[model samples]
Every structure is written in structure tokens, then in C-alpha cells.
Target: MEQEKDTKSNGDDVSRLEKYKEELIAIHHKSQETFEQQLSYISAGSLALSIGFVKDIVKDIDCAGYRPLLGIGWVLMVITLLLNLVSHLLAVKFYRKSISEIHRNEFVSSKSDTRFDKITWLNWTCVGTLVLGILLIIIFVNHNL
Candidate 1:
């Protein structure tokens, strides 16, 4: 009878809906944990590493409150910190959509390859400048002394 057929279809729909609902909850739970991990743990590591590097560099510069060398090191540390924050933010935003192949492809498309190249170039430039500045400071101080 048509009534029997209708009842069977309804039961199927109910079971399917329940299954999907459970799957969705699991995906959301995982996404939330991943986001929190990046924002908290990963970012914390970057913060500590950057600050520690600068702190070590400036260990003996307490007397020169306005030392340009220390300032440059601090600037590099801050730049590195900001880059890590941005990367973590991107990873968090993509964590949920990361389930879909299409979404993953979209994420890959959105990020610029050239941007990473430029960052590399800038890093090298900054390092070169730092070395030059240190050499200049040593030369000038040595001559003066």
C-alpha cells in the first residue's frame, strides 16, 4: 500500500538526518580544537622564540637605552612575530573548510607563491643590512677608541 511505502521513506530520511547531524558535530568539534591550538600553542612558540632571540642579543645593552642595534633586532623580531600570527590565522580559517577538496584547492589558490618569495628576499635583505650596520658600528667605535 502507498501508506506503507510512505512510512518506509520517512524512516529512511530520519536515519539519514541523524547520521549527518552526528558527522557535522564531529567536524565542528575538530575544527574548533585545531583553531584553538594554532591561536594558542603555535603562536605562543613564535612569541617566545622571537622575544628570546632579541633578549639574548640585548643582554649586555642595558646601558645603551637607545641602542640602534638593539632596536633593529627588536624590529626583526616583531616582523617575524607578525608573520607567524598571520600564518596561524590563515591555518585556523582553513581548518573547517579543509575537509573539502574544493575548499583546499581554493585555499591554495588564494595564497600567493610570489609573496613567499618576496618574504624570503626581504629576510635576506634585512640580515644583510644588520651585518652591515654591525660592521659600521664596530669600525666607527674602533676608530674612535
Candidate 2:
């Protein structure tokens, strides 16, 4: 009976480990997908703002004396774009590291465990920056109008 209980306990541990690994993989995939979407949207918006709206923005600023506000808004949007890119890149880096660790059956260190948290922090920072950027742009446009 003692031997049997030990074997059963070992089996349960293996089962739990497998489940944990699956959860980690799922979270990693979701993070990657979310970051990609953010990066793409920001990249396209920034490009459009720069290329399609520059002449109009300049004309509006010349007429309205909101040059400083427009400049600040544009700068904020650039910062948002950069933050998203950095977050996406770092997520990819840490995701690969996680997969490599799993494949090697290596023990996870405390530092390695914090990678996910770091990723989350980066994502939130990107989002907050994006919101601030949009607010600046809105203020600029309203002023220009």
C-alpha cells in the first residue's frame, strides 16, 4: 500500500506539471498575438499620420497657432509606436527562452519566472502610452479645428 501511494502521488505530480506547461504555452501564444496586433495597428496609424496628414497638419498649425501642441502630439505618437515595438520584441525573446527551457527540462529560476511579469508590465506601459498619445492627438485636432 505504501509503494502504491507513492506511485500514485508521482503520477499526480506529472499530471499537474503537464497541465502547468500547457497553461504557460497558451499564455505565451496569447501574449504574442496581442502584441502583434498592437504593433501592426500602431505602425500603420503612425505611418498614415506622418505621410497623409503632414500637409494638412502644417496648414492647420499655420492658421491656428497650435504648432507646439501638434509637435507634442506627434512626439507622443512616436513614443507609443516605439514602446509597442519594444514590448513585442521583448515578448518574442522571452517566449523563445521559455520554450527552450521547457524542451530542455530545465528548472525555472526566479528570474526566469519574472519574465512573464516583465512582459505584462511592458504591455501595460504600451497601452498607457497609447492612450496618452491618442489624447494628445485629439487635443491637437480639436484645437486645430
Candidate 3:
């Protein structure tokens, strides 16, 4: 029957949609993990490299004039690291809340989730601060050289 065929086709479409949704969710989670991990590593590495550069390479130069720039860069890097940590914690809470809501058959969209919003903001802030910190460090090194 044509009607029967139509019903079967609709069911197939629904299942395919569900499969795609699951795949997308998995990819989203993986990308988030990668972003956070990579950013943290880069920020920490930058801090260490800056310190080593000053101690080993710029040892003879009087860095007092541009020291404040380096100090601010260090502070920014620290803040980036702290914000990344807080974002991780918030992400955990968000996932827990999402799971609970799913178990309860209550759907809360990510746009309306405060924890999700905070995580998003924290991620942006971390990137911004890291970039600013790197720029400051570059300026400090240039001045010393």
C-alpha cells in the first residue's frame, strides 16, 4: 500500500535524524575537550618560555624599564589559566544538569542554561587574555632586545 510505504519512509527519516543528532553531539563534545586542553597547554607553555627567555637570554639586559609589561603579561596568563579551570568545573556541572534533565524528561535548551553561558563566556575570555598576554610578552622582549 502506498500509505504503508509512506509511513515506513517517515520512520526511516526519523531514525536517520536521531543518528545524525547523536553524531553531532559527540563531535561537539570532542571539539570542546580539545579546545580547552590545547588552550591550557599553550598558555602554560607561553608562561614558561617567557620566564626562560628572560632568565637565560636576556640576562645581561637591565629589564627594569619593561618589567611591568612582563608582570602584566604574567598576570594575564595566570588569569587565563584560572578561567580555563573554572570553565572545566562549570562544564562538568552543566553536563550533570543536562543528564538530570534528560532523565526527568525535562528539556532545557543550552541557550537558556546559565552554566553553559558561563562556560562560553569563560572560553572567549580565556582566548582574549591569552592573546593579550602573548602580545605584551612580545613587546617586552622587543624592548629588551
- The per-candidate count of clashes, in order, stands at 0, 0, 0
Worst 10 residues of 3 by lDDT: 57-66
* Per-residue alpha-carbon lDDT of candidate 1 for residues 1-145, written as tens digits (9 for 90 to 100): 9999999999999999999999997996686446444434433443465346445643454443445644554454445445545544554444444446354565453444443444445434534544444454444333322
Candidate RMSDs in order: 12.1, 3.9, 1.8
Estimate, for each residue in 22-129, the C-alpha lDDT of model 3 and write its tens digit. 999899899999999998998999899999988888885464458888999999999999999999988998898888888888867854476687888999999999
Residue 95, candidate 3: alpha-carbon lDDT: 90
The TM-score obtained by model 2 is 0.67
- Runs in model 2 deviating more than 4 A are 1-24, 46-54, 57-60
Tell me, by lDDT, which candidate is best: 3
Per-residue lDDT of model 2, residues 1-145, tens digit only: 9999999999999999999999998997886787758665874585467435556654544575555665666666677677667877887788789779889988487768798788778777767766676676666666655
Off by over 4 Å in 1: 57-145
Q: Could you estimate the TM-score for every candidate?
A: 0.39, 0.67, 0.91
Relative to the true structure, candidate 1 reaches a TM of: 0.39
lDDT of every model, 2 decimals: 0.51, 0.71, 0.89
